[model samples]
Target: MNALAAELRGILQGPVLVGELLGRHTTWRIGGPAELFVAPRSEQELLAVLHLLAQVGMPWMALGTGSNLLVRDGGYRGAIIHMGALQTMEFRDDGTARVGGGLPVMRLVRQAVRRGLAGIEDLAGIPATVGGAVVMNAGAGEQAMAGVLQGAFLAGAEGMEYWPAARLDLRYRASAVPADRIVAAAILRFSFADAEMLESSVQHRLSARRKAQGVGKPNAGSVFKNPPGQQAWRLIDESGMRGRSVGGAQVSEKHANFIVNRGGARAADVLSLIGEIQETVRGRTGIMLEPEVQVIGEA
Candidate 1:
């Protein structure tokens, strides 16, 4: 272990894993290991760790639920700041909910539904954390985190600061949250709705998602972004790449945009299949497919 990593272990109030297997954390169930993985229980602890890392110029990445990431087989060389322990949620006097970064997206949706809050029902079946959703501007149908966000608490070397929704340049599936900064919490504005109506809406969306995109396989949701005026799944289907397999990874037959790990799939298998799909779709349809899933670590 290095001097900085040793210092980090001493200072942190949470469990620090050295050479932690990252595959278990990610939704794809791929990746090798992280040199250092720290999960802070509180915002203060997270900030302190961030300050120390910045002072020493140590590399780090803020990991949420690991929904849309693909860490390479060689593993991540830097520290991973895991946010799974920061799961706090509370309502504000202004009728908005303040949710911590580590809170699961599905849990938040359920809470909102119970409180008769609408707007986030579309995210009922999405597998991610609130921080990841906000950073990626995650959405379905016409609803997105961008539309319901009031403000966000961001932590960095300078400490925590609240930024309004306007500051987070939310494009289609992207956000303006600085890459180096970690999302601490967010204030979301929700509309009052009938409890029964909200519950029904959430259920309907979940059921539709299950049918359209099978919940049976172990997959990382959508792999590619939809090109302008074109859906990614339709394009892949047109290219006849659905059910295509590389090693143990297969393009989901139910949803062409999703890549499922049939069993014992590795990072290399997923990447190879991704490349093949991209090449095939591009060569046939002339539309370049862009990956929505973030690929990290060594190739």
Candidate 2:
């Protein structure tokens, strides 16, 4: 492990953390330690790290704020790449914003509102990075990331390149970005709007999100994606699973679609709760609920 860490450190300018606890980096405050954790300072450094990993046949996963992820209790054996350093932000005169994938979605929304841009204000409160948002098609009500994304820069072992939004094949809480690539940056389009009006809309959206999905507990936002025309929260509520618990994991009382950690929760606890919810909902409504939050790493 030390040798691998030293190798990773040798290849990149960013800090390489050995055996860093994944819980500290994730919003859920769960998961065990990562064998090799890195925060690459640039895309070039990231590509270098990738090449090294490929040469050694080591597995890895990209992380963007960790708001929509769950790592198991046993943790991941390979690299965990943190994209927080690539937070460059630039707005064009043609009503488009060129932003880094590591930039927080909330920050983008807030900045857009300040610039009187109207498109992603409804996504103001989602606790995800731009890359994560793009991958998950993250949104609220009827708006989604698919609606605003123009294109993105993706990085792979071969090289970094731009893939238009049309190529992304973004759907509800999912995207077609190949597992081999990572979002490096993105270009999003927005329309001009009154700054005051945009700010007001953002405020309203934040309030609505808090009232509906915010549980004031450690959680990975919505647990399940809304299936077709039906809402996952409605189904869970109708199934009487609200406030249900397994170990330290519990179905949020505020929102049935969310599973919150009361304290000392494990990935197994959450997974068990998710399975129970899916089974109960499927039996009652005949619709199997799919998770919106990603579950990764070992058991």
lDDT, candidate 2, residue 122? 82
Per-residue CA lDDT of model 2 for 1-299, tens digit only, reads 78878987887888999889999988889999998999999888988888888888888999999999999999988999999998989999889988988999988988889988888888888889998899888988668899889999999888898999999999877899989889999999998999999899888988888788768899998889889999999999999999999999999999888899999999999999999999999999999999988999889
- lDDT for model 2: 0.90
Report lDDT (Cα) of residue 75, candidate 1.
92
- Residue 126 miss distance in model 2 (angstroms): 0.3
Query: TM-score of each candidate?
Result: 0.97, 0.97
What TM-score would you give candidate 1 relative to the actual structure?
0.97
What's the lDDT for residue 222 in model 1? Answer: 94
Model 1 C-alpha lDDT per residue in residues 206-257, reported as the tens digit of each score? 8999899884767889999999999999999999999999998999988999
Which pairs clash inside model 2? none
Span of 10 residues, lowest total lDDT, candidate 2: 206-215
